[model samples]
Target: MILFVSGCASTYSTRSVEPSGFLGDYSQMRAGAEEDVQLIYVNPQADFGRYRKIMMDPVSVYVTPDSYLRKVPKEQLSMLVNELDAAIKTQLTPHYEFVHEPQAGAMRLRIAITEAQGANVALDTVSTVVPVGLAISAARRAVFGTHSSIGKAGIEMEILDAETGQRLWAMVDERAGRKITGKFDKFSKWRTTHDASEYWADLVKERLESLQAEHAASTP
Candidate 1:
Protein backbone atom coordinates (compact mmCIF):
# COMPACT_ATOMS: atom_id res chain seq x y z
CA MET A 1 0.00 0.00 0.00
CA ILE A 2 2.86 2.36 0.81
CA LEU A 3 4.55 1.53 -2.50
CA PHE A 4 1.31 2.01 -4.35
CA VAL A 5 0.79 5.41 -2.77
CA SER A 6 4.43 6.33 -3.33
CA GLY A 7 4.19 5.30 -6.95
CA CYS A 8 1.10 7.43 -7.33
CA ALA A 9 3.09 10.39 -5.98
CA SER A 10 5.23 10.51 -9.11
CA THR A 11 5.97 13.67 -11.10
CA TYR A 12 6.43 14.48 -14.80
CA SER A 13 7.05 17.60 -16.86
CA THR A 14 6.69 18.68 -20.52
CA ARG A 15 7.28 21.84 -22.52
CA SER A 16 5.67 23.39 -25.61
CA VAL A 17 6.33 26.54 -27.62
CA GLU A 18 4.43 29.73 -26.78
CA PRO A 19 5.06 31.26 -30.19
CA SER A 20 7.64 34.10 -30.31
CA GLY A 21 8.98 36.38 -33.09
CA PHE A 22 7.87 33.91 -35.83
CA LEU A 23 5.52 30.97 -36.16
CA GLY A 24 6.41 28.38 -38.79
CA ASP A 25 9.74 27.02 -39.91
CA TYR A 26 9.59 28.68 -43.31
CA SER A 27 11.23 32.03 -44.14
CA GLN A 28 7.90 33.82 -44.59
CA MET A 29 6.82 33.23 -41.01
CA ARG A 30 9.11 36.06 -39.89
CA ALA A 31 7.98 38.72 -42.36
CA GLY A 32 4.33 37.77 -42.04
CA ALA A 33 4.40 38.44 -38.31
CA GLU A 34 4.95 42.19 -38.65
CA GLU A 35 1.69 43.04 -40.36
CA ASP A 36 -0.69 45.48 -38.67
CA VAL A 37 -3.57 43.41 -37.39
CA GLN A 38 -7.03 44.04 -36.07
CA LEU A 39 -9.36 41.99 -33.94
CA ILE A 40 -12.11 42.31 -36.63
CA TYR A 41 -14.02 39.65 -34.73
CA VAL A 42 -13.43 37.41 -31.80
CA ASN A 43 -14.69 33.95 -30.98
CA PRO A 44 -14.14 32.88 -27.40
CA GLN A 45 -14.89 29.40 -28.67
CA ALA A 46 -14.64 28.71 -32.39
CA ASP A 47 -16.21 25.51 -33.69
CA PHE A 48 -17.78 22.20 -32.71
CA GLY A 49 -20.14 24.87 -31.47
CA ARG A 50 -16.86 26.68 -30.57
CA TYR A 51 -14.22 24.07 -29.72
CA ARG A 52 -12.12 22.56 -32.53
CA LYS A 53 -10.10 19.36 -32.56
CA ILE A 54 -6.99 18.19 -34.37
CA MET A 55 -6.04 14.68 -35.41
CA MET A 56 -2.94 14.52 -33.23
CA ASP A 57 -3.51 12.49 -30.08
CA PRO A 58 -2.99 13.90 -26.59
CA VAL A 59 0.30 12.62 -25.19
CA SER A 60 1.49 11.84 -21.69
CA VAL A 61 5.27 12.18 -21.83
CA TYR A 62 7.62 12.20 -18.88
CA VAL A 63 9.93 15.19 -18.90
CA THR A 64 12.19 13.23 -16.53
CA PRO A 65 13.01 9.70 -17.75
CA ASP A 66 11.86 11.19 -21.08
CA SER A 67 10.65 8.00 -22.71
CA TYR A 68 7.27 6.90 -21.46
CA LEU A 69 4.50 8.53 -23.46
CA ARG A 70 1.12 7.16 -24.42
CA LYS A 71 -1.34 8.67 -26.84
CA VAL A 72 -4.77 9.54 -25.49
CA PRO A 73 -7.60 8.43 -27.76
CA LYS A 74 -9.42 10.83 -30.09
CA GLU A 75 -12.67 9.93 -28.36
CA GLN A 76 -11.38 11.58 -25.20
CA LEU A 77 -10.42 14.63 -27.19
CA SER A 78 -13.82 14.74 -28.86
CA MET A 79 -15.68 14.41 -25.60
CA LEU A 80 -13.57 17.02 -23.84
CA VAL A 81 -13.83 19.47 -26.72
CA ASN A 82 -17.61 19.33 -26.69
CA GLU A 83 -17.69 19.90 -22.95
CA LEU A 84 -15.29 22.82 -23.16
CA ASP A 85 -17.22 24.39 -26.01
CA ALA A 86 -20.41 24.26 -24.03
CA ALA A 87 -18.66 25.76 -21.02
CA ILE A 88 -17.05 28.64 -22.95
CA LYS A 89 -20.15 29.35 -25.03
CA THR A 90 -22.07 29.72 -21.83
CA GLN A 91 -19.92 32.84 -21.34
CA LEU A 92 -19.01 33.87 -24.92
CA THR A 93 -19.88 32.94 -28.49
CA PRO A 94 -17.81 31.20 -31.18
CA HIS A 95 -14.80 33.47 -31.74
CA TYR A 96 -14.41 33.10 -35.47
CA GLU A 97 -15.28 31.19 -38.63
CA PHE A 98 -13.69 27.98 -39.87
CA VAL A 99 -12.77 28.66 -43.49
CA HIS A 100 -11.61 25.05 -44.00
CA GLU A 101 -7.86 25.62 -43.86
CA PRO A 102 -5.79 28.14 -41.93
CA GLN A 103 -4.70 29.66 -45.26
CA ALA A 104 -8.18 29.97 -46.63
CA GLY A 105 -8.54 33.72 -46.10
CA ALA A 106 -9.30 35.38 -42.77
CA MET A 107 -7.45 34.88 -39.50
CA ARG A 108 -8.06 31.39 -38.17
CA LEU A 109 -8.27 30.27 -34.59
CA ARG A 110 -7.55 26.60 -34.08
CA ILE A 111 -8.05 24.95 -30.72
CA ALA A 112 -6.37 21.66 -30.13
CA ILE A 113 -6.40 19.64 -26.96
CA THR A 114 -2.63 19.79 -26.69
CA GLU A 115 -2.53 18.04 -23.32
CA ALA A 116 -5.09 16.40 -21.03
CA GLN A 117 -3.71 14.37 -18.11
CA GLY A 118 -5.60 13.19 -15.02
CA ALA A 119 -3.37 10.62 -13.41
CA ASN A 120 -2.35 11.08 -9.80
CA VAL A 121 1.40 11.69 -9.59
CA ALA A 122 2.41 11.00 -6.03
CA LEU A 123 4.89 13.60 -4.87
CA ASP A 124 5.60 14.84 -1.39
CA THR A 125 8.62 16.61 -2.94
CA VAL A 126 8.29 20.40 -3.04
CA SER A 127 9.65 20.73 -6.56
CA THR A 128 7.62 18.33 -8.69
CA VAL A 129 7.42 20.89 -11.50
CA VAL A 130 3.81 20.69 -12.63
CA PRO A 131 3.60 22.06 -16.17
CA VAL A 132 0.37 23.94 -15.47
CA GLY A 133 1.09 24.20 -11.75
CA LEU A 134 -2.02 22.17 -11.02
CA ALA A 135 -2.86 18.77 -9.67
CA ILE A 136 -4.03 15.71 -11.59
CA SER A 137 -7.36 15.51 -13.44
CA ALA A 138 -10.19 13.50 -11.90
CA ALA A 139 -13.98 13.27 -11.99
CA ARG A 140 -16.30 15.01 -9.51
CA ARG A 141 -20.00 14.26 -9.96
CA ALA A 142 -21.45 17.06 -7.89
CA VAL A 143 -20.27 20.74 -7.71
CA PHE A 144 -22.32 22.15 -10.60
CA GLY A 145 -25.20 19.96 -9.59
CA THR A 146 -25.98 16.33 -8.78
CA HIS A 147 -25.30 15.08 -12.32
CA SER A 148 -22.31 12.81 -12.82
CA SER A 149 -19.38 14.11 -14.86
CA ILE A 150 -17.67 11.78 -17.26
CA GLY A 151 -14.18 13.32 -16.98
CA LYS A 152 -12.23 16.53 -17.16
CA ALA A 153 -12.54 19.13 -19.90
CA GLY A 154 -9.35 20.83 -21.10
CA ILE A 155 -8.77 23.09 -24.12
CA GLU A 156 -5.89 24.93 -25.75
CA MET A 157 -6.37 27.57 -28.42
CA GLU A 158 -3.89 28.88 -30.97
CA ILE A 159 -4.81 31.95 -32.98
CA LEU A 160 -2.93 32.14 -36.24
CA ASP A 161 -3.08 34.50 -39.13
CA ALA A 162 -4.44 32.30 -41.89
CA GLU A 163 -2.57 34.20 -44.58
CA THR A 164 0.73 33.97 -42.76
CA GLY A 165 0.09 30.78 -40.85
CA GLN A 166 1.64 32.36 -37.78
CA ARG A 167 0.34 31.74 -34.30
CA LEU A 168 -0.16 35.13 -32.68
CA TRP A 169 -1.74 34.23 -29.40
CA ALA A 170 -2.69 31.11 -27.54
CA MET A 171 -4.05 29.90 -24.23
CA VAL A 172 -4.20 26.51 -22.49
CA ASP A 173 -6.69 25.78 -19.75
CA GLU A 174 -8.40 22.91 -17.92
CA ARG A 175 -11.58 22.61 -15.92
CA ALA A 176 -12.54 20.02 -13.30
CA GLY A 177 -15.58 17.81 -13.67
CA ARG A 178 -16.64 14.49 -12.20
CA LYS A 179 -17.41 10.94 -13.27
CA ILE A 180 -19.91 8.68 -11.55
CA THR A 181 -18.04 6.16 -9.43
CA GLY A 182 -21.15 4.04 -8.95
CA LYS A 183 -24.81 4.95 -9.17
CA PHE A 184 -24.16 8.52 -8.00
CA ASP A 185 -20.83 8.62 -6.19
CA LYS A 186 -18.74 11.61 -7.33
CA PHE A 187 -15.11 12.63 -7.06
CA SER A 188 -12.78 15.34 -8.33
CA LYS A 189 -11.70 14.44 -11.88
CA TRP A 190 -8.57 16.40 -11.04
CA ARG A 191 -6.16 16.15 -8.17
CA THR A 192 -6.87 19.75 -7.27
CA THR A 193 -10.24 20.99 -6.12
CA HIS A 194 -10.78 23.82 -8.61
CA ASP A 195 -11.56 24.42 -12.26
CA ALA A 196 -8.52 26.15 -13.75
CA SER A 197 -10.07 27.37 -16.98
CA GLU A 198 -11.64 30.41 -15.36
CA TYR A 199 -8.37 31.42 -13.80
CA TRP A 200 -6.41 30.89 -17.03
CA ALA A 201 -8.95 32.78 -19.11
CA ASP A 202 -8.80 35.75 -16.79
CA LEU A 203 -5.02 35.64 -16.87
CA VAL A 204 -4.96 35.59 -20.67
CA LYS A 205 -7.53 38.32 -20.93
CA GLU A 206 -5.55 40.45 -18.49
CA ARG A 207 -2.43 40.10 -20.61
CA LEU A 208 -4.36 40.90 -23.78
CA GLU A 209 -5.97 43.91 -22.22
CA SER A 210 -2.63 45.11 -20.93
CA LEU A 211 -1.05 44.74 -24.36
CA GLN A 212 -3.94 46.62 -25.87
CA ALA A 213 -3.49 49.42 -23.38
CA GLU A 214 0.24 49.54 -24.07
CA HIS A 215 -0.36 49.78 -27.80
CA ALA A 216 -2.85 52.56 -27.24
CA ALA A 217 -0.52 54.30 -24.80
CA SER A 218 2.28 54.22 -27.36
CA THR A 219 0.10 55.55 -30.17
CA PRO A 220 -1.06 59.12 -29.49
Candidate 2:
Protein backbone atom coordinates (compact mmCIF):
# COMPACT_ATOMS: atom_id res chain seq x y z
CA MET A 1 0.00 0.00 0.00
CA ILE A 2 1.23 3.47 -0.93
CA LEU A 3 1.09 5.77 2.04
CA PHE A 4 0.79 9.48 1.24
CA VAL A 5 3.74 11.45 2.55
CA SER A 6 3.31 15.13 3.44
CA GLY A 7 0.46 15.45 1.00
CA CYS A 8 2.38 15.44 -2.26
CA ALA A 9 5.32 17.56 -1.12
CA SER A 10 8.32 16.55 -3.21
CA THR A 11 11.96 17.63 -3.01
CA TYR A 12 12.53 17.03 -6.70
CA SER A 13 9.58 19.02 -7.91
CA THR A 14 10.48 22.33 -9.57
CA ARG A 15 7.05 23.75 -8.84
CA SER A 16 6.75 25.88 -5.73
CA VAL A 17 4.76 24.67 -2.73
CA GLU A 18 1.53 26.29 -1.77
CA PRO A 19 1.45 28.05 1.56
CA SER A 20 0.21 26.00 4.53
CA GLY A 21 -1.38 29.22 5.90
CA PHE A 22 0.55 28.93 9.14
CA LEU A 23 2.14 32.38 8.69
CA GLY A 24 -1.25 34.13 8.22
CA ASP A 25 0.11 36.53 5.58
CA TYR A 26 2.23 35.78 2.54
CA SER A 27 1.99 39.10 0.74
CA GLN A 28 5.58 40.24 1.30
CA MET A 29 7.40 36.97 0.78
CA ARG A 30 9.59 36.35 -2.24
CA ALA A 31 11.85 33.59 -3.46
CA GLY A 32 14.86 32.89 -1.25
CA ALA A 33 18.33 33.69 -2.60
CA GLU A 34 20.07 30.40 -1.86
CA GLU A 35 17.55 27.84 -2.96
CA ASP A 36 14.37 26.93 -4.83
CA VAL A 37 12.69 25.47 -1.74
CA GLN A 38 12.52 28.71 0.19
CA LEU A 39 10.21 31.73 0.31
CA ILE A 40 11.38 34.49 2.62
CA TYR A 41 10.79 38.08 3.62
CA VAL A 42 12.48 40.60 5.88
CA ASN A 43 11.09 43.83 7.19
CA PRO A 44 13.41 46.49 5.85
CA GLN A 45 12.65 48.90 8.63
CA ALA A 46 13.47 46.45 11.41
CA ASP A 47 16.77 46.92 13.21
CA PHE A 48 18.56 43.63 13.58
CA GLY A 49 21.59 44.93 15.48
CA ARG A 50 19.53 46.05 18.44
CA TYR A 51 18.44 42.50 19.30
CA ARG A 52 20.79 40.44 21.46
CA LYS A 53 18.35 37.90 22.83
CA ILE A 54 15.70 35.60 21.46
CA MET A 55 12.56 33.93 22.83
CA MET A 56 11.95 30.83 20.78
CA ASP A 57 8.62 29.07 21.03
CA PRO A 58 8.37 25.31 21.07
CA VAL A 59 8.12 23.89 17.56
CA SER A 60 4.63 22.71 16.62
CA VAL A 61 2.91 20.50 14.08
CA TYR A 62 0.49 22.28 11.79
CA VAL A 63 -0.39 20.17 8.82
CA THR A 64 -2.41 21.96 6.21
CA PRO A 65 -5.02 21.23 3.51
CA ASP A 66 -6.86 19.59 6.37
CA SER A 67 -5.47 16.08 7.06
CA TYR A 68 -2.38 15.07 5.14
CA LEU A 69 -0.17 13.92 7.99
CA ARG A 70 -2.70 11.68 9.71
CA LYS A 71 -0.94 8.55 8.58
CA VAL A 72 2.14 9.49 10.60
CA PRO A 73 1.83 8.42 14.23
CA LYS A 74 1.48 11.08 16.93
CA GLU A 75 4.66 9.89 18.63
CA GLN A 76 6.57 10.31 15.40
CA LEU A 77 5.28 13.87 15.14
CA SER A 78 6.37 14.53 18.69
CA MET A 79 9.81 13.21 17.94
CA LEU A 80 10.04 15.36 14.85
CA VAL A 81 9.13 18.52 16.75
CA ASN A 82 11.59 17.73 19.50
CA GLU A 83 14.33 17.08 16.97
CA LEU A 84 13.69 20.40 15.28
CA ASP A 85 13.76 22.24 18.58
CA ALA A 86 17.05 20.64 19.54
CA ALA A 87 18.64 21.35 16.19
CA ILE A 88 17.62 25.02 16.16
CA LYS A 89 18.67 25.61 19.74
CA THR A 90 22.01 23.94 19.10
CA GLN A 91 22.63 26.17 16.11
CA LEU A 92 21.56 29.46 17.67
CA THR A 93 22.67 29.15 21.30
CA PRO A 94 26.22 30.34 20.65
CA HIS A 95 25.17 33.66 19.09
CA TYR A 96 22.08 34.64 21.04
CA GLU A 97 20.77 34.40 24.57
CA PHE A 98 17.65 32.30 24.82
CA VAL A 99 15.01 33.76 27.05
CA HIS A 100 11.60 32.69 28.30
CA GLU A 101 9.87 36.04 28.28
CA PRO A 102 9.71 39.17 26.18
CA GLN A 103 12.48 41.56 27.14
CA ALA A 104 14.42 44.47 25.80
CA GLY A 105 16.54 43.66 22.75
CA ALA A 106 14.83 40.33 22.39
CA MET A 107 13.11 38.86 19.33
CA ARG A 108 10.38 36.23 19.43
CA LEU A 109 10.71 33.36 17.03
CA ARG A 110 7.88 30.96 16.14
CA ILE A 111 8.20 27.85 14.03
CA ALA A 112 5.89 25.15 12.78
CA ILE A 113 6.46 21.84 11.08
CA THR A 114 3.96 21.85 8.28
CA GLU A 115 4.80 18.75 6.32
CA ALA A 116 6.96 15.59 6.23
CA GLN A 117 7.20 12.75 3.78
CA GLY A 118 6.40 9.23 4.97
CA ALA A 119 9.17 6.71 5.55
CA ASN A 120 10.29 4.10 3.03
CA VAL A 121 8.99 0.54 3.23
CA ALA A 122 11.69 -0.62 5.61
CA LEU A 123 11.04 2.17 8.07
CA ASP A 124 7.33 1.58 7.90
CA THR A 125 7.70 -1.85 9.48
CA VAL A 126 9.79 -0.75 12.43
CA SER A 127 7.72 -0.36 15.61
CA THR A 128 10.09 1.62 17.75
CA VAL A 129 11.71 4.97 17.06
CA VAL A 130 14.53 4.78 14.52
CA PRO A 131 17.99 6.22 15.00
CA VAL A 132 18.42 9.36 12.90
CA GLY A 133 21.20 9.69 10.32
CA LEU A 134 21.65 11.53 7.02
CA ALA A 135 22.88 9.15 4.38
CA ILE A 136 21.79 9.64 0.78
CA SER A 137 21.76 7.51 -2.33
CA ALA A 138 24.15 8.13 -5.25
CA ALA A 139 21.52 7.93 -7.95
CA ARG A 140 19.26 10.43 -6.19
CA ARG A 141 22.18 12.80 -5.65
CA ALA A 142 23.01 12.88 -9.36
CA VAL A 143 19.37 13.42 -10.24
CA PHE A 144 18.09 15.78 -7.54
CA GLY A 145 20.78 16.52 -4.94
CA THR A 146 18.54 14.74 -2.42
CA HIS A 147 18.42 11.40 -0.65
CA SER A 148 16.66 8.55 -2.29
CA SER A 149 14.01 6.63 -0.35
CA ILE A 150 14.50 8.92 2.66
CA GLY A 151 11.84 11.50 3.41
CA LYS A 152 11.89 15.31 3.37
CA ALA A 153 10.44 17.94 5.69
CA GLY A 154 8.88 21.41 5.35
CA ILE A 155 8.54 24.23 7.85
CA GLU A 156 7.37 27.82 8.39
CA MET A 157 9.06 30.37 10.62
CA GLU A 158 8.67 33.99 11.66
CA ILE A 159 10.55 36.37 13.89
CA LEU A 160 8.94 39.25 15.72
CA ASP A 161 9.89 42.09 18.04
CA ALA A 162 9.37 40.85 21.57
CA GLU A 163 8.31 44.25 22.79
CA THR A 164 5.92 45.33 20.08
CA GLY A 165 4.99 41.99 18.53
CA GLN A 166 5.86 43.29 15.08
CA ARG A 167 7.07 40.77 12.56
CA LEU A 168 10.70 41.20 11.57
CA TRP A 169 11.31 38.24 9.29
CA ALA A 170 9.54 35.20 7.91
CA MET A 171 10.36 32.13 5.87
CA VAL A 172 8.88 28.92 4.48
CA ASP A 173 11.07 26.15 3.21
CA GLU A 174 11.38 22.41 2.58
CA ARG A 175 14.41 20.16 2.23
CA ALA A 176 15.63 16.62 1.70
CA GLY A 177 18.71 14.97 3.21
CA ARG A 178 22.23 15.40 1.81
CA LYS A 179 24.31 12.70 0.17
CA ILE A 180 27.16 11.05 2.12
CA THR A 181 29.59 9.49 -0.31
CA GLY A 182 31.12 6.05 0.52
CA LYS A 183 28.73 5.76 3.48
CA PHE A 184 25.40 4.71 2.03
CA ASP A 185 21.78 4.32 3.14
CA LYS A 186 22.39 4.56 6.88
CA PHE A 187 19.05 6.26 7.08
CA SER A 188 16.73 7.58 9.72
CA LYS A 189 13.28 8.80 8.81
CA TRP A 190 13.76 12.03 10.73
CA ARG A 191 17.31 12.87 9.69
CA THR A 192 16.27 15.09 6.80
CA THR A 193 13.95 17.00 9.09
CA HIS A 194 16.73 17.46 11.61
CA ASP A 195 19.17 18.62 8.94
CA ALA A 196 16.63 21.00 7.47
CA SER A 197 15.91 22.52 10.86
CA GLU A 198 19.61 23.07 11.47
CA TYR A 199 19.99 24.66 8.05
CA TRP A 200 17.17 27.08 8.79
CA ALA A 201 18.63 27.96 12.15
CA ASP A 202 22.00 28.70 10.53
CA LEU A 203 20.23 30.82 7.94
CA VAL A 204 18.66 32.81 10.73
CA LYS A 205 22.09 33.49 12.21
CA GLU A 206 23.58 34.39 8.83
CA ARG A 207 20.76 36.78 7.99
CA LEU A 208 20.89 38.48 11.37
CA GLU A 209 24.66 38.92 11.20
CA SER A 210 24.39 40.38 7.71
CA LEU A 211 21.78 42.82 8.88
CA GLN A 212 23.87 43.71 11.90
CA ALA A 213 26.88 44.41 9.72
CA GLU A 214 24.79 46.59 7.44
CA HIS A 215 23.31 48.34 10.43
CA ALA A 216 26.72 49.02 11.92
CA ALA A 217 28.05 50.42 8.66
CA SER A 218 25.16 52.87 8.38
CA THR A 219 25.38 54.02 12.01
CA PRO A 220 26.88 57.44 12.64
Task: Specify the highest-lDDT model's number.
Answer: 2
CA error at residue 68 for candidate 2, angstroms:
4.5
> For residues 126-177, what per-residue lDDT tens digits would candidate 2 score against the true structure?
3112324222254445666555555667888999999899999898877764
lDDT of 2 at 186: 39
lDDT of 1 by residue, 1-220 (tens): 0001111111111112222212123222221111111111232232222223212122222121221113445565455455544433333333333345444435454444433454332331111234222232211122232112223333445555565654545544333332212222223333321233333333333434444455556555
Question: How many residue pairs of model 2 clash at the backbone?
Answer: 0
lDDT of each: 0.32, 0.70
RMSD of candidates 1 onward, in order: 14.6, 8.4
Please identify model 2 stretches exceeding 4 Å from their true place.
1-14, 34-37, 66-68, 121-148, 178-185
